[model samples]
Target: MNTDYTAQEIQDLVSEVLETADENGVLPIVQLGHPVLRQRATAYNGQLPTQMLEELLEAMRQTMYDAPGVGLAAPQVGIPLQIAVLEDLYPIPESSALEREREPLEYFEIFNPSFVATSDRQAEFFEGCLSFDGFQGVVTRPADITASFEDREGKEQSRSFSGWQARIVQHETDHLFGTVYVDKVETRSLINESELWHHDDLDVATARRVLNF
Candidate 1:
């Protein structure tokens, strides 16, 4: 896939993908081995018309929700653009949510997103990607961050996020730069999703010991 595209090229590409979407309007998510996943995504710069961009974002949002994931980036859908959508309603048990310092987040779209850690503190948790289904691994990330991005209206915005929200932002932003969780994960801690239940309740330290990572 080409790493860079002109405005018309992007519009054409997005149009084609959207037109061929499944009945649910979910675009096909490219998998781990796809070259697009490894290439740094091109920055967004009015390459798509307003309405077309909105349509593309809506489809990506549906795709993310259908995947049941907190976030999705353009590269995951083969667009290779610096755009992503994120939301986390904290669907897990209250106990688990509290354990992970998770809080509910409403859905939102971001373009040309970037972030910086706000604290030295870090947290480790099992992170999964829509691109790499049915597997997860322990990845440590900054526990807090301040992200800068353009909202759906192209307005520049900056905000701070902590705990699980911070992790989600970092994960999606990394996708724009061609980085995946597995690249930063404790490899020995990798496991099939079917086996994830065994470690769900364990703290990072305990999980690390049990997984020998």
Candidate 2:
């Protein structure tokens, strides 16, 4: 059956699916048109049950892994809490010329995160989000950042990140502030994921050459 849903209907349907996610499994990821994806998420006040928070974070991690994305935010899953999970555990290959300096990032979670630019230097890269499926956009962000956030147990954790790791954290943190990569991308730089991937050219130079970004 073919059905055309209005934006509000789609948003409501996404919320319903998230609300009914398996108790110990992946949650539905809300897409671009949902209002929840556009709202600034509320800060975590350490009031929710610790057990519940644990399960949610675990489910978020599982969802992120299933989507095979570098990060996932609570808002993307239809939760307005200030929480996100990210990991870039594998190294960039030597063939990725622009990212050879990047290092592997261990799994981490952040709540109510905030960041400060450690350098005035800026860098541009293509980024994709679970919420903005099937498209990638070019965004320029500070080359280095230091961020602070609460851990799962309500303990404070502060860290500095650079290279791809810095990009991952900044992208996820922006979600908490109601900002998506589309909002900051160069208009001419958006490319469908299929055209950008599924080819031998995976470096910045090749991307700019072919996509004209």
Candidate 3:
């Protein structure tokens, strides 16, 4: 996919993907090796008709929920546009939730989103990507952030997020810039999905020692 697109080109691209969707309307997620995932996404600029964009967002929302992931970006679905959908409905143990400072986030879509770290504080946690299923690594990121983005109706919105929500924002926005969690992950902390359980209950210091990161 190209880094930039004309309005008509955007419409055509979305139309083609929607038309080719399976019976469940789930778009195929591009993997790590896909060229589209490495390209910076084109910013939204009324390129797609409102209705068409809505359809695309809905499809992406469905795809994200189907993958059981907290977020999904346009590039992940081979659409090189600065759009992403996010939500976290999965239940977790109270202890784990408090440890990660994680909370449930309602579903929302962001277009051309950007953010900045709000403080010097950092947090490290195991992160996974739908693009590379069954793999995870410990990534350190700012614990607080302020983000700005256009909503589905093209309204500009700005908000502050902390903890897991902030991580979700940064992770999804990074995709628009062609960055992935693995790029910032501790190499020694990379592990297979099944091994996550072994380290999941460990404290950060213990995990670091065990993983030798």
The full ranking of all candidates by TM-score, starting with the best, is 1, 3, 2
Model 1's TM-score against the true structure: 0.95
Q: Write the per-residue lDDT of candidate 2 for residues 46-90, one digit (tens) a residue.
A: 645555667677888989988889999988987776889999765
Off by over 4 Å in 1: 198-200
Q: What is the lDDT of residue 138 in candidate 3?
A: 85
Report the Cα lDDT for candidate 3: 0.89
Give the TM-scores of the predictions, in the order they appear: 0.95, 0.86, 0.95
Global lDDT of each candidate:
0.89, 0.80, 0.89
- Candidate 3's TM-score reads 0.95
Per model, how many backbone clashes are there? 0, 0, 0
